[model samples]
Every structure is written in C-alpha cells, then in structure tokens.
Target chain A: MPVTLKDVAQKLDLSITTVSRALAGYSDVAAATRQRVLSTAEEMGYVPNVTARHLRQQRTDTIGFIIPSEGPRFSDPFFNELMAGLGNEAAAHEFDVLVSIHVPGVEEEAAYRRMVYGRRVDGVVIVRIRHDDWRIRFLQQEAFPFVCFGRSEVPGDYPYIGVDGTLGMYLLTRHFIESGHQRIAYIAAPPHFFFATDRKAGFRQALAEAGIPLEKELEILGDLTQQGGYLAMKELLSRFPSADTKPTAIAACNDLMALGAMAAIQDAGLDVGEDIAVGGFDDIPPAAHSHPPLTTVRQPIYQIGAQVMRTLVQLVQHEPLAQRHIVLEPELVIRKSG
Target chain B: MPVTLKDVAQKLDLSITTVSRALAGYSDVAAATRQRVLSTAEEMGYVPNVTARHLRQQRTDTIGFIIPSEGPRFSDPFFNELMAGLGNEAAAHEFDVLVSIHVPGVEEEAAYRRMVYGRRVDGVVIVRIRHDDWRIRFLQQEAFPFVCFGRSEVPGDYPYIGVDGTLGMYLLTRHFIESGHQRIAYIAAPPHFFFATDRKAGFRQALAEAGIPLEKELEILGDLTQQGGYLAMKELLSRFPSADTKPTAIAACNDLMALGAMAAIQDAGLDVGEDIAVGGFDDIPPAAHSHPPLTTVRQPIYQIGAQVMRTLVQLVQHEPLAQRHIVLEPELVIRKSG
Candidate 1:
C-alpha cells in the first residue's frame, strides 16, 4: 500500500498543509519542520507523482533548456558555461533542469514540438536565437513562459536575457587596433544568426571609427566553426588580389574559429602575433589554455544561466519583470593570440 | 472555469483515460489522437500544475542527473563524453536532466549535501566516486537508487557502471614495452584517486612481467591538470640525474595532462616521436586536434550514461539487475603521441 500524505501528517502529528508545503520544497516552510517532513517522507518511501506519472514528486520542480538544433560540431562553449550556471541555480532552488538539443540536421523541429506540447516543462530557457526563429514565435503564440540567451533579431515582446555581443566585438576590434594593426580581417559567420550579424556590425563599426576601409576580402564569411575558419582563412589568403598588404591582424567571431585560423596561418608558415595578430570572441575554456592562450571576449557565461533561470521562474510565477531584455557585458581578455 | 481532464474529455467526446494518456505522451495512444489532444489543450491555454498541488496527475516527469560537482578544468574527455551521451538519451526520453557544478575552492561537499537533502531530485546519478564518498554511502544506506560513473575502490556492494582502468593501463603499458621502450615514465594524478592507483598497479604489473626494474624517478605524481603535467615533466627532466638514459616514453592517465606533458617536452626542446613518446587515457575532444594527436584509452563515455540510465530505470521499476557492478572495457586508440 502506498503511503498517503494524510498518513504522513497523521504520523507526524502535524497538519496536512504543513506536511504538504515541506514536502514540496516550498521556501515558506520552516527549515526544521521541512526537514522533519522530508525525513519522514523518505522513511515512508513516498514518491510524489509528477503531473502525469506516479514516480516523482507531484510538481515536476523542473526547468527546461532548449538549444537550437545547431550542428553537432557547432556546439558552442557558451552552452557549457550557461548550463553550469543553470545547474548551480537550479540546485539551489532544489529544482531540476532538463536540457533538450534540437540538432539542426535531423528532426530538429520535432524535439521542440515534443518539449512544448508533451514534456510540459515547468518553464523553458532558449539559447542561440536565429533570424526568423520559429521558437520565439511558438513561445509567443503558445504563451509559454520562456527566457532567451540571445534575443531574436525579430523579437516579439517576449521576456529575454541577452549578452552584449555588439559591445564585446567592439571591444575586441578596438584591442586589435590598439595592438598596432592597420588592415584587419574579420572571420565572421554568415549573416543568418542574429549573434553573427550583431558581432559583425560591432566589428565594422569599430573599424569605421578608426578610419579603415572595410574590404570584402578581409571579411572571411563562413559557418561559426574552427574547420570553417581554417577553410575560410585558406580561401582569404589565396583568393585575395593583394599580397603586399595582407591584413596585419584577423579578429574571429568566436574562439574555435580563431584557433582554426591560427592553424591555417601556422601551416602557411606565418607567425600568429609576428605575421598577423589574431583575436576571437567567447573566451571559452580552451581560450585560456591554447598554445598562445587566445585573447577573446569574456562574457559571464555562468551568470547568464543563473539570471535566465531567475527570470524564467519570475515569468512562471506571474511576477513582473522590471526589464525584459537583460544584457550582460563582455570583457576583453587579451593573451598571446592578440 | 479550470479545464479539468474530465472537461477536456467531454469536449473531445473521448474517455478521461484516453485524454489523459494522449496528453501524457503514452505510446498506447495513436499519434493523430495525441495531436488532437495537444492542439485542443493548447487552444484551451492549459498549463499543467507543475507543483502538483491540486491535480492528481501531478507527476514531475523530471529525471535528476547529479553531475559530479567537479569543475570543467578538472574534467577531461571522459566526463564531457558522458554528458554528450546523457544529453542524447535524456532528450530522446522527453525528460529533462539537471546539472550542477561543484567548484573545488568553493562549497564543494556542502553544495552536494544541500542538493540531495533538498528533495530536488526524483533519482540521482552520481559521477566519479571518492574513497570516503559520503554521497555514495548516503545513497547506499538510505537505499536511494543511484548509478555511479566509476566503481568504488572499496567494492562489494554498490550500484555502479565503470571502465576497467587497471586492465586498460596494463594493455597500454604492455604496448609501450613491446615497442622497445624499457625506461618508461607514468605522468599520473595523486595516489588518492582509485583510477590513478589502479592504473599505477597495472603499470607495475606490466613492468614486472616484462622483467623491467621499477624506478621511483620514472613516476611523476601531481594534480590531474595540464599545468600539473607540465610541472611534473620539468621536475622529471631536471632531477632524474640520468642524462645517459632518460625515459623513452611517458603515459599520462588522462589527455589534458598528456597535452601538458607534450608541451613540456617541446619546451624542453625534445622531439615527440623521435625523442620520446607520450600517451594519455580517456581520449578527450581536443586530443584528436593536438599538434600530434595523442594515443589514448577510449572509454565508452556515452554508452555508460545510457546503460546506467537503462539500469537505473530498471531499478526504479523494481526489476532485477543481473549485477550490481557494471564493468565496461577500455580500448587502446593509437595516435601520433605514442
């Protein structure tokens, strides 16, 4: 026979409401009382039923994170940091978070469709928004509570938390210019992703301010990947008409691509800093340990998750968000690469 | 005004069970039927009571993944692979997995203690067992169902899935001996870790069988870090005092340390393939991309999580497990490092 909540309350000589609040991890419950209820419940082997199942607690007490179905190789360092932060906060809230990856290649749409409809996550946190994002649209129409890591270029009045990529790129490009580089290159992603576009805007804006003419050949456009950068760098060097004035420095949109560009430069028998200074964005884990210890933009990756979670929780609880668009600053971390 | 399951059933002219199952994503229902239920529910603006406060169907449907609170720097290729694998499985099951980090200098043990005691998880998955692991012991004595990433050294009664590190090291060391490297060095972690101790034992066993004398100078111990490996290499090179016959090969227990050791060798102006061979265990993502790709022992990090989950699901269902100790094999991958 399954032990009932009533049985627990009766056994503990307490009211059912106290037992209920304590069992649910409610913050309002007194710590000592909650502990007693929890211990008693565990002792009784009481498994609370999730919404539709009898295995877990009545409330899912779970948050969901959805990463756009980006390619497998395209998994960003940003995701890892954000996840670590979300995990940290969720644990503190005694809430479990579920992360769903919608790989762009196979059945991307189906994953989100299932999560929103069936998985019925308590709230959802979406990262890496692209232009014409169906996800933002879905969340808006569905009125599902969500928080975005990077706001959509075509945002629809949904609560979002975004990092200042524009400022980050501006700072990175300024660093390269200050390091005594005249003709600079930008290893950027295509103008599809909002993040890519914003970063490019920042790059071009900084260069324009410095009175440098932006050349099409200098803007090495490719997917946001090291291999893409490697291949792009090869094409940039070979395809460019002028050999005498090769860009003295190249700034990558992300660290992985920066590393790849470095490899290509090294393969071409050019020193990274001596021949051409290289810089990257997203000061990922490998940024610190790279052969040259890459100089890049350092965004508070972990804090973003915590803030996003807190924001999502607020949305779920019908609390007023003082601001919808929460922007975190990206600091420039200079190393041997720049 | 609340849209109860009964209200939903009446509106759809279907039984309450059919309506419930369809919303719950049960396989018994037809796809079209499930679709209809979802569409209707969405139209009704129905949000399931995640707290499970009022609804009898409040099952959280969330799975708790207790990430070994170890930081990213401490993790090599093994933990990352496990996470990737776990992510795939968790997504497929339509369940969210929670992640938490345990920073070393920060509140490491207390962080874990809080997460578990807080009743945040339905079921916990533990990674990397320590010698006096309070978490494992707590789960065991309390009969809390858990799956460990590595087996406990003090074996004989715990549910765990892990690779045979001792056997893996023995094979790799035997390969080194066969390749005509009699004087070998093992760049490994502190002796406290079970994997390190087991690997050292394997190294010793291989040396004994090959009739090679064991030398203390050939053993380098430090933290499981790249810098640690680099520092260890510097120490081994300076203090060995045997300039005539230095170690011909070095095997790090993991890839990060191996890469560091490789860097250290380069800093020492020694050729990798020509002068000395270096290898590591648990083939990390960057291992393949290193200047000379590292040879390593490949553990099935992904399958470990899936298999552990499968085993855990069985435990949750009260199904009989064939064995409490699930031992996996580690394969030797030959690369440029060795």
Candidate 2:
C-alpha cells in the first residue's frame, strides 16, 4: 500500500494541512517543520499523488506532441529523430511527453482542444506547419503555450524554430546549374506545407539567376514519400520518351523521395550521378548509405526538436524567451549523387 | 471564460449537487432532471475538468511507454513505427500515450515508480524485456496493470506479445548452412536481453543439427547498433588476417548491425552478395532499401505495438482478455544480400 498524506500526518502527530503545506514548500511553514516533514515523508516511502498535486498547482508537467500523420502506416525517420529529442529533453526535466496521431483536420483540432481545455498537458510542440495553420491560430486564441517547428503564413507573432528551406533548395539547385546541367527537374512536396512553397521558390530563384525559363513539365508535386517520388519521376520520364529530352538533374524535397527517384532512374536504365544527378533535403541516416550516396541539404532535426521542447517549457513557466522566432541555416552536403 | 458546473446548474435552476450528480450519470438522479442537466451543459459548452473527474474515478486514461534508450541520439525506425501504431490506436479510444526515454537502471526504475504510485498513467506497456526483469516483478507486487512486448526469464504468468526469435534465427542460419557456407559468423546482441538469448540459442541449434562444432571465435557480441556491428565485424576480420580464414557468411541479430557488417565487408574490398553473404533480423524499412537489399526475418512490429496497447487497455478496464500470452511467428524474407 502507498503512504498517503493522512497517514504521514497521523504518524508525525501533525495536522494534515500543515504536513501537506510543508511538503509542498509553502513558506508559511517553519523551516525546521518543512525539513522534518520531508524526512518523514521520505522515510515512509511517500510518493505524492501526482494527479492531485497537479490539480492543486494547475499544472500537469506534461508536454503534448500531436503527430500530424496520414494513418497507422506512417513511418518517417525524421519524426523518429525529432521524437527522441523531444522525449529525451522532457524526461531530463521530469516532464512526460503525451503523444497522439491525427490527420490535420477536425480530429487533430479536437486532440489539441482536449489537451488544452482538459489540462492534460502544460504545453505542446507543433510540427509540419501548413500555410495559415489553424493550429497556430487556435493556440493563440486560447492563449495556450506552444512552440512550433515551422512557421505559418498567418500575420501573427509566435515562437518557432524553422530551417531555411528556400536557401537549402537554392543551394542544391545552384550546384546543378553550375555543373553545366541545363535540363533540371524538381520533385516537390504538397503545396499545403509552408516549407514546400519556400523550397519551390528557391528552385525557381536558381533557375531565374541562370536565365533558364521555368518549365511546367520539369516540376512535379509529390506526396513527400518514396512511392510518390517514384510515380512522379515515372510520369516525368513518360512525358519525354526520348533520352535526349530527359532531365539531366533532379532535386527532391526530401530524402525518401530522392531515394525513390533514384530507384526509378535505375529502372529506366539511367545511371544515377552519371545520366541524372540527384539531390535531397533533410539529410537522413539512409542518405549517407544509399548507393552512390545522396547529396542533400542538412538540417539539425534532433537539435531543433530539443530546442523547441526547451522553448515550450520556458513558455509554460511564463519565462522570457531569448528569441521568439529563429530561422536556422541549412548546409549543403556534397556526395556522389550530385 | 470556460463554462463551469455552477453556471450550468444556475442556468438550469437546479441545485449544484443535483446538477453534478446528473452530469456524472448517477443512478440516483431522476431521468428528466438528467436530461435537462445534460442539455443545459451541452448548450453552455461545459467542458468537465478531466483531472478532477479522474481523481474521483481513480482513472487517468493514459498509457505509459518508457523508451529504454542510450540518449537523445537514439534513432530507431522500429520505435517510430511502433509509436505510430500505439498512438493511433490509443487516440481512437480517447486515451493519451505518455512517453519518456531513460537508460535502464535507477532512473528508469524511478520513472516506472512515478507512473505507478503517482497515478500518472492507468497502465504501462513494457518493451525490450531483460532477463529476470525487475520491472515486471515490481509492477506485479504493486498490482499495477501492464502488458509486456517480450517475456522475462522470471517464472510467472504475465500478459505479453512476443515474436519467436528462436525460430526466426534458426531458419536464417539453416538457409546459410544449406547454401554451402561452413565458415559462417553470428553477431549477437547483449546477453541481458530476452530476445538476444533466444536468437543466440536458435543460431546454435541450427549449427548443432548440421554437426558443426561451435567456434567461439566465430561468434561476436554486438550492441545492436550499426556502429556496434561495424566494429564487431572489424574485430572479426582482424582476428583472421587472410580472406580464406575469414567468415564467408555473417548473420547479425538485427538489421542495423547487419548493415554495418555489410559496410565493413565493402571496406575490406569484398563484394556483399558474391564474396560474403549477410543476413539480418527485424526487416526494418531500411532493410529493403539497403545496398544489395537485406535478407532478414520480418516481424510485424506495428501490429504488435497495436496489439500490446489493446491488451493493456483491456487489462486496465478489467475486461476479459482474448489471449493472455501470444508468441507470433517471424517470417524469413529473402533478398539479394543472401
């Protein structure tokens, strides 16, 4: 049986209210009384009822992370690394990470509402921001504490840490243009994502700088998955039946898609890094291990996850932040693929 | 401002106690009064205080999962897939999944204690069972609800869902033996893990049936990481300086280690499929995409995660479980690596 506050108070011959207040570190209790209460509680193996204490303090000491996923089949290494960062940091601070998976719509909103209105968590960490994200708006409206991994286009200030996708894509695209490749293609993520829009702008910026006209046929939208990238590349190849009319280079918004594009290229009897230069973003673990390897834009995903969690904690505690909005620079990693 | 029970009672012209009892669905409350209270509360947008309700009901409606990890650097796609399954199913049932990462030892024990005694979670899902696991013992002694992913060596009846590692390894090892490879090596996981012990037994069982004497030098222990596998393979190669004396076939306990062994083989100027055959377990997503692809034992990790959670929920609710203990068969997936 677990020791309760009443049991401890009875053993110490003190009032239950006094023992509770002393254990809670309320200054109204004498210093010696507080010390005595702590020692007695420890000796009795008294583990405080966290739910009861949280109700009194109006704090759960939990961080919520609602994964915006398609379904149960969602498997992204990026989320794995990010979750490790968030969970590790939260655990270090004696906070539990409460997680749920919901698509970005009514269900997702309800999950967030439950966490906020029900006081299930102290704060939340938001990822994969969409254009004019309603999550941000809802959190802001409720005055709920949260930190985002990406920024939204909504005209409001919020705390966030985002990678410079536009700059990352620009660097990769510029590398292909400088390599004397005039016929370059890009596989993009869904346009609903904010990073997708930024990345596409970077691709165009590089093409415009080289005085190359943007070809609608060269740009394809993918679902940010391996299969999606494979189908998009197959469609691009089918549009140009002849070898000479095929793209000389392809840039994927993510590593999974890039890997799929590489597979499609190989199936088409085109050698990667020779017939078609391929590059990707978010330098995941497999990026370095792929055949011929992959040239990619590197972002510190784990670090960002950790930082976002730290910021959310600070926000929950009403502490002043060092920076409200941070945009991190992405680095280009040169490999055999590009 | 959030609507409260007091406001609902006042609007409905009922006593606070009556309103509360009616909202709680107490049998003593009159049916017409209950209907009026419910309609008034719904119209007023009254979101009940979950913490207060949980305190009264003695239920948290939260499942705990403590990830046994090295640190923030831990990146495993297997966990990612499992988490997706756990989180998705839990959300469908309106339960939140509480997560924390801790190395196995005192810190991990404290995490479990806090979740149990502090009433932070209604039930816990235990993974990566160690031999004679103390966690199971503690939870059992406390009479807390828990479902394990693997069984401990400790003699007791417990609810668990485990993959048959012994059979999985036996089949892989037998395949190598039939392929005319006498000089086969096995990279084992740490001995403390239950699956590691089972897998090693299977490896030895296959060798014994073939009348091959167990060579201590041919079996190496790996930390179940890519780096660990790489270093173990390097040590195995260093032991036998000549190509003829080195292992012609290698089997790693997990895919990460197998991939590392493949890298080491390539570094030694040996072709993977032609010169040295490699096999791995777990058949993670990277297994299929790996260079030369990995021949591995496939366990439905995502489904297992879902099943574990479902069983845990049933345990917590005191519902009759369909199966108390389940041992699933693992399938052998052959690819180019072998």
Candidate 3:
C-alpha cells in the first residue's frame, strides 16, 4: 500500500498539516519535526507522490539549462565542463538539471517555444546570448527567473552572471605587451556574441592605455575555434610579410584558437613564444599541457556554474538579488606561450 | 487578448483536434494541413501558454538522463560527446534532455519521483548499470519506458544499446601482443560496472588464446578518473618493479587512464612507448593530442546515443522493435603509444 501523509502523521503523533509541511520541505517546520518525519519516512521507505503536491504548490524543483546552437559553442569543451559543474551543484541543492538544445531559427520565438512551452523547465540558465538578442526581451517580458552566461549591451534589471571578458582580454594583451611584443594580432569571435564585443573592447582599451595605436589590419574575427584560428592565421600570413608585417604576438579568443595559432606558427616555420608569442582565453585543462604550454585566462566556469545555482536558489527562495549584474573576473594563467 | 487554439482553428476552418495535433508534432498530420495550420497560427500571432498547457497535460516533454557518479564513464570527455549526440537526437525528436546527478540518497528513485510525481519529465535514459541496479527494477515494475546506454547481464525485453567492450578489449590486447608485448597488465575501472566485467573477460580470453598465463597481480581495479588511474598506476609500480615484474604493455580501460598511465610512466622516469607501451579505450579527442598519442578504441559514442534515442522513438510509438539489445562495434585507432 502507498503510504499517505495521514499514516506518517499518526505514526509520529503529529498533526496532518505539520507532517505535510515537513514532507514538503517547508521552512516553518521545526528542525526536530522535519528530522523525525524524514527519518520515519526513510525507515518506512515512504516516497511521496509529488505530482499532485507539485500541482498544488506550483514548484517543480528543477532548473532548465538552455544550450543554444547558434554559434559553434555547442561543440566546444568549455560548455561541457560548465554543464558538469552545474549538474553537481544542482544535485547538491536538491534540484534537477534539464538541458535543452534549440537551433537558431529565423527568429528567437522558435527557441523560446522549445524551452518555454514544450519543455516547461522550472527556471532557466541561458547560454550563448547574442547582441540585441530577442531572447533577453522575451525573458524580460515574461519576468522569467533566468541567468545568462554571457552579458548583453542593453543590460536590464535581470539578475545575471558572466565572466568579465573585457578585463580578461585586457590583462592578456597587457601581458603580451610587457613580454616585449609589438604589433599584436587579436583573433576574435563574431561580433554577434557579447563576449566578442567585450574582448574587442579590452584589446582596444589595453592598446590605447599602452599609447599604441590599434591596427585594423591585425584584427580578424575568428569563430573561436582551432579551425577558425588556423584559417585566420593563414590569411594573416598571406596578407603580410613574415618579419615586417606579421605581428610578433597573437591573442586568440579561446584555447582552441590559441592551439590553432601555434599550429599555424609552426607550419610557417616560426617557433611559438620565441619567434612569436601566443595566448588564449578559457584556460581549459589541456591549456597547461599544450606544446610550449598556453598563456590564457582561467574563466572559473565551474565556480560560475556553482554561483549560478546558488543565485537561482536565492531567487527561488524569493530573496533579493543584486540590482547590477554580478560580473566575475577571470584570472591570467601564464605559461610558456607568453 | 491572448490568441486561443479554438480561435485559430475557427480562423483556419479546421477541427480543433487537427489544429492541436499539427501544433503538437504528430507525424500523421498531412503536410499541407500542418503548413496551413502553422501559417494560420502565425497569422494569428499565437504563443503557447505553457503553464496552462502543463496544468492540463501533466507533462513537460523532457526525458531525464541519469549519470552515475560512481563510474569514470559518467564524467569523461566521451561522456560529454555522448551527451551532445543525445541532445541533438532529443531535440530532433522534440524532447528536452534533463541530466540528474546520481548520489547515494538521491539515487535513481529521485528520477522516477521527478518524472511521475513532480511531472518534471516524461521518460528517462539510464547509463552505467550494475548487475543488480535498483533503477532497472523500479522502472520495470512501474512499466516505465526507458533505454539503457549499456546492457545488463540479465536482460528481459527492455530496450538496451551497448558498445561491444569485449571486442574492444580483445582488439587492443591483440595489438599489444603483435607489437612484441608479451607481459601485459590490465589497468581497469571498478569491478562493479558491466563494461569492466566484459572488458576483463575479453582481456583474459585474449591472453588464454595467446598461451599467456593470467597473473592476478597484473590486474588493478580502481576509480575511472585520471587522478584515480594515476593513484592506481603508482600502486602498480610500487607492487611491480620495472626490472623484473614490470609489464611491457599496459591496457587501460579508458583514455583518461591511458593518459594517466603515460603520466605515471614519465613520473617513474620511464619512456612511455619505449619502456611501457600503453593503450586505452574510448578514443577521446585528447587521446590524439596526448604526449606519445594514445592508442585507443574509437567507440562511436555519438552514434550510440543517436541509436538509443532512435530506438526509444520506436518504443514511444509502440512500434515493433527489431532487437531487444543492439550492440555497436568499437573501432581500433592505433596511435604512437601502441
């Protein structure tokens, strides 16, 4: 026979409402009462039928993580690590992690339909946001409790979290400059994504602060992939002379691109960190093991995911969140590449 | 005013059921009928109120995938690739993928609770099963339709897809022998997982066929992570000296272990290929880039996931399944380490 709340209440000699609240994980329940109810339930192997209870409570205890397949972020390893971190944190917080993938349609409505309608995940964690993204507008209008992995230009009152890409990029560029490098090439991602714009901003800011003029010829928007960086390097080598025109330093938007840059440099008969210095962002596990190692920024993606869950918990608990968007700074992990 | 389904149906001169079925992605709808209904809905500028629909349907259209924290199989790069593949397939099939982290108290029962009680997900995909897994029995008793990523010892009519670990280990072991490695040690994961047993069976089978005696001291079983493998490798080195008891070749259960073995060999002041040729299964991307380029089995994990979802579609549709258990063959990718 399925155990009911009344049976648990009778066994514990407590009122039905008290047993119900304890089972529902209500805060008003005394700690001893909650413990007794939990222990008795465990001993009796009581599994509450939550569907009916959830219908009444309007709480599902699940967080939906939406992975947008707009750019090549889906194929990258950074997203995978972030997912793992989120999975662990969600488990600790007694929440389920729902990962939904939606392809970029002609508009953002289709993507919204996938998450908001068909799936109906509790709260959402939106990754890979674009500049002037309709997703932000849709989420804002709905008043949905969500955290964005990337920031937007027109920031709103949404409690969001993301890496400080501008500062990370500036630090990397400054490190290259201090390492006796000039004419540094910046291999960036597409401007559609917010990170690309922020990274570009940092590069420009660092160059300006160093009293060095920005060279439009040295900046190429790569797709934040090794293949993209390789193609960009090829174009760089072809358009300019090896010694006179080719930049002495290269800062890629990601580790994959930095590795690609290294491959290109070696193929061009130039040694990395000697003939040419190279750096990347998102200091992945392999960043330290790469050929001559890679100088990159550690995004603390795992911690970001942990924080995202913690923040969502606060939101779910109806606690006040920060008015301004919380931006976590990235650290520079220097290695042989620089 | 919100656009209603009935209003859209009346506007299109179609039955409410037909309009509803077309919107819900029922394949039986005529293409012309679907296109007409969709265009009419677009003209009406309808956005589905998921909260209302969820209240009625008692569903989220999200299937949970449970990854056990006990095994290395759950958190590896190959696991990520499998997830990506599954995500793509799930999206194509119009289902959201929910990942639940497996813990002791919050085990597989939590998944069923979320699906049936909380109405968080419709179905589940269970990976890394032991012989006496409670998840299998619970789902079986509940008559819940689920697909196993790996098969069990006592299978009965439930849909299961598996990678042929026996054949994979046989091939890797054969490679080691052919490369003049007579004494080979098997560094594997914990003995509880089905794959570990299957892999051990194949290892013994190959050695018995080659007329090599099976030494109990040669096989070491531990955790599946790189750190786990590193610790196990250190223990193996301490137990077996390089001068006498050392095996010329070591067959690691997975690429993470293979990488760890390489590190262990280098830490022991020994060359990887020259002193101890190491091989691992699961040709993860890093296997190709690792120092000395790990030789490993290239299991089409993405294809496996795709196949599992495709098979689950049959179950969901109540179609005749061609096979109860579908086993995929593993490809041997020979690299410099072997």
Q: What is the C-alpha local distance difference test score of candidate 3?
A: 0.77
TM-score (C-alpha) between model 3 and the true structure: 0.83
Candidate 2 regions exceeding 4 Å error are A26-32, B17-36
* Model 1 chain A: worst 10 consecutive residues (lDDT sum): A50-59
Q: Is candidate 2 or candidate 3 better by lDDT?
A: 2
lDDT of 3 by residue, A1-338 (tens): 35667888899999989988898799999999899999997777666654445545566677877676545224556766678778888877878787766557643356565455433556777766788877778777767677777688755777678889999999999998888777899998888888888888888888999988988999987877677787888787777785777798999988878877787887787878888888999887667656567899888777777778778867876888764377888999998888
Give per-model TM-scores. Answer: 0.81, 0.96, 0.83
lDDT of 1 by residue, A156-218 (tens): 788777778889999989888887788888988767788898899899999999998888878
- Best candidate, TM-score: 2
User: Candidate 1 vs candidate 2: which has greater TM-score?
Assistant: 2
Worst 10 residues of 2 chain A by lDDT: A69-78
DockQ, all candidates in order = 0.29, 0.76, 0.34
Compared with the true structure, what per-residue lDDT tens digits does model 1 show for residues B1-338? Answer: 23567777788898989988899899999999999989997787554544343234322334566555444433344555676666666666554565656654345555444444444444568776677677777776666667787877554476889888888888889889989999899987776566778778878899999999998878988677777888988887786656567888888887878888888887787877668888888777667666566787887667887777666666765689988887888999888778
Per-residue lDDT over B1-338 for candidate 3, one digit per residue giving the tens place of the 0 to 100 score: 35768989998888889999999889989999999999999888776655456557655555778766653213467767677778888777776677876654455566566565444556678777777777778777767678899878754678889889999999999888888788899998777788898887878888988999999888998577776777778888888874777888989998888787777787788888888888998887667766677899888777788778777766765678898788888888988787
Candidate 2, residues B1-338, lDDT tens digits: the string is: 56778899889888989999998789999999999999888888788777887887889999999999854488877788788878877877788899988888899999998999998899999998898899999898888999999767777778999889999999999999999989889999999999999998889999999998899999999998787888999899898888788888998999989998888887887888889999999988778877678999998888899999999988998999999999999999999899
Candidate 2 falls in which docking quality class?
Answer: medium
Better candidate by TM-score, 1 or 3: 3
Clashing pairs in 3: A51-B117
